[model samples]
Target: MQTLEKPKPKYTGKRHRLSKPELLAPAGNLEKLKFAIHYGADAVYIGGQHYGLRSNADNFSFEEMREGVEFAKKYGAKVFVATNIYAHNEDIEGIEDYLRNLEEVGISAIIVADPIIIETAKRVAPKLEVHLSTQQSTVNWQAVKFWKEEGLPRVVLGRETSLEEIAEIKKHVDIEIETFIHGAMCSSYSGRCVLSNHFTDRDSNRGGCCQSCRWKYDLFEDARPAEAWISEEEARESSVLKNFKLGVTQLPLFNEDDNAFSMSSKDLCMLESIPELIEVGIDSFKIEGRMKSIHYVATVVNVYRQAIDSYMADPENYVLKPEWIEEINKAANRPLNTGFFFNTPDHEDHIYEPEEKAVPYDFAGLVLEYDEETGTAVIQQRNYFKPGQEIEFFGPDGTFFKQTVGQIWDEDGNELDAARHPLQRIRMKVDKPVRYFDMMRKRK
Candidate 1:
């Protein structure tokens, strides 16, 4: 056997400190990656086509990853990839090469869960820094120390850890600590639910999560479920008893006043608690939504960027603006809560009824090119909008104005009553100036 000469050394620069916390955003694809960085994310985490845990996302090709990295470089930002899938025997086949490719493509780091993946990256892809995924559920300083000693640069703490515990962890270990400050929460511990695998045959840890935890279910005193409460034989027997009365009645633990029973949680929002999170010495604030829309990415990123800058610029003068809350709510989201931050979430932290999800705004269009002299702007439609409908425009700098949609024209100069077709380019008069990448939304 022959060894290559490039196997010179292992990564020694594992643990370090950044002067300021980075705003880490999720990028499901190349476009979202660009938008997140353009809107002021310090770093963006993306998933490759294979090995990453977002098989449902339009995960990047190596070319797209390279492009994203280059784009982020232009903004002095960074790009990380999520090769964080827990692997089976078959999943290990080409991982070493994949890790090598990631490093070659200039990926700043990788968020990994499986121990084997971490060790492999350290050995085969030493240039790619490894950040432990939240799936490890690192809750204490001990686990953090172990990882830091093992030469990992950072640990994304479990969502269950509160600010006090985070401060304690930071005090004990001088390692980069990342935490999820916003987005969805799992009913199970750090999203390690077996319902997806056991019920729908999709492995959540390996990227095929069904989010079964959010689905509505019927709780019956008499019904035997597939869990340990009932034996498989008895549950199977109960399942086959549809024809026979069996002298048993199924009763649900719900009422008609509500929509239904679901174990789903309210989405997390740490906008108001930014100062506390900064005080805890968190190195990164992660937002969890790789499959979300581009509008969601831009809006959330823009809001957080402004809030963080405002606070860091003047902590004494920092104020949580009401407009920031309003802008964030305009994005598509479930009810917002501070999950496990204040305390263990009670009933108030969950959305038992999906009907509680509030979507007050519809993303209407994206500004492709604005003509200043003619007072016209060309937009690619997202949702339907018609003449005389009230719409609002906003940019990454947080400028927005409400205006009634006036006369619209197609590219062929034909007057249109409505912008009905998706991605249809339409020209319209603008009372205020809008430019490239500005977005328009309609209030519901």
Candidate 2:
């Protein structure tokens, strides 16, 4: 590759210390929320049952949201609630009540997209800080400044933005800038696609997205199987004589195929670029999976936590653990990319098939009870754990240590070959101290 030309540097820009930003993960439900906090998240953003995007996600209830806020605070982590859905007249009616409740719950911040919600939050949740969600499409300094003037404390810039652009935007804007450091990539611009609503009446803005972008397709025209699409699976299996373009095209009468783009872009992995992001003046690094499993949440949180800590210890010579990258791959991911961070994305960056295949290294469970006196730890396994298998333990402080199992005993003190049953309690001895939220796994 040829060396690219450099742009002239602007001398009049403001500079800021680019320390490690807060690692923000997503929590679709209470379990995921708790797992992210315990594993290593400095903060987590979640959508409530109403007003936010991600309608299908297992959102928090009033009671759960209250507990979630308290739970995160207990661990010195902040919680931001997303109230970012575009509003209609009906949505505007209950805006005050929504903001008032969020303020009462002591939420760390409110992620807003709609102007009505922003206006309402200022009056109703006056004490609550507001962060502009990426759904608002603040891609440049001008847009970010406009939102900041409206009292937003922070802004999540668009996904398509490059790292250098973000740095430039940071130079021009005074408010905090948060960008998605990891997790799923939306095919549409900043996740504002109307494909779900246009195709299935499920509003993407209201969070009922059916993900039409990832849908499979076969090109066709004139209501007959053309030479271009004759070999398509749908055309071959059709009981109806008429042939039509399948997936993201004009709709036909029988839309039998699951053209919902169910297998979307794999989650983004940025463990390798944590240092670069910090240098770009990002104030918060956001993770994008709220509908993920607790194990998924825990693994991702712990890996990123370790990555950040490693960078802080030695910015110049920090080397991310090979195991940490391995752990991220163990989570749900598509082909990994530096993404727009590198300013150029290859064709392979977009995944068309399935994401990464499932691995056996699922999170087993927590070390619920430990008896350092007896040199044994009581564990509640979320999945099976074979005796003699080695695993990484993520401690309460997010410090990781390696351990090999020696003996396994059931809850009743009977010898067991392995902790293979779901949610089963087992007694095991480790070489070192293992705290709650410490994870164990056997890789495939």
Best by the lDDT measure:
1
lDDT of 2 by residue, 1-444 (tens): 875975332222423343768999999988888888988899988888789888888788878889998998888998889998899788888889878888888788989888888888888778989888888777888999998888788999888788789878887888889999887787667656888888899888888787787776544434555543657776656655443434433444434552323435545678888877776778898888887777778888878888888777666577867877877777754666766776656556666554446644667767887788987888888877777787766654455677777789888899988887888988988778777667776565
Count of backbone clashes, every candidate in sequence: 0, 5
Native-structure RMSD, model 1: 10.2
- Please report how far candidate 1 places residue 312 from its true position, in Å: 0.9
Badly placed stretches (over 4 Å) of model 1 are: 1-19, 220-261, 356-358
Residue-by-residue lDDT tens digits, candidate 1, 84-152: 777889989899999999999999999998889999999999999999999888999999999999899
Residue 401's lDDT within candidate 1 is: 91
Candidate 1 to truth, TM: 0.87
Error of 2 at 267 (Å): 3.2
Output the worst ten-in-a-row residue range by lDDT, candidate 1: 8-17
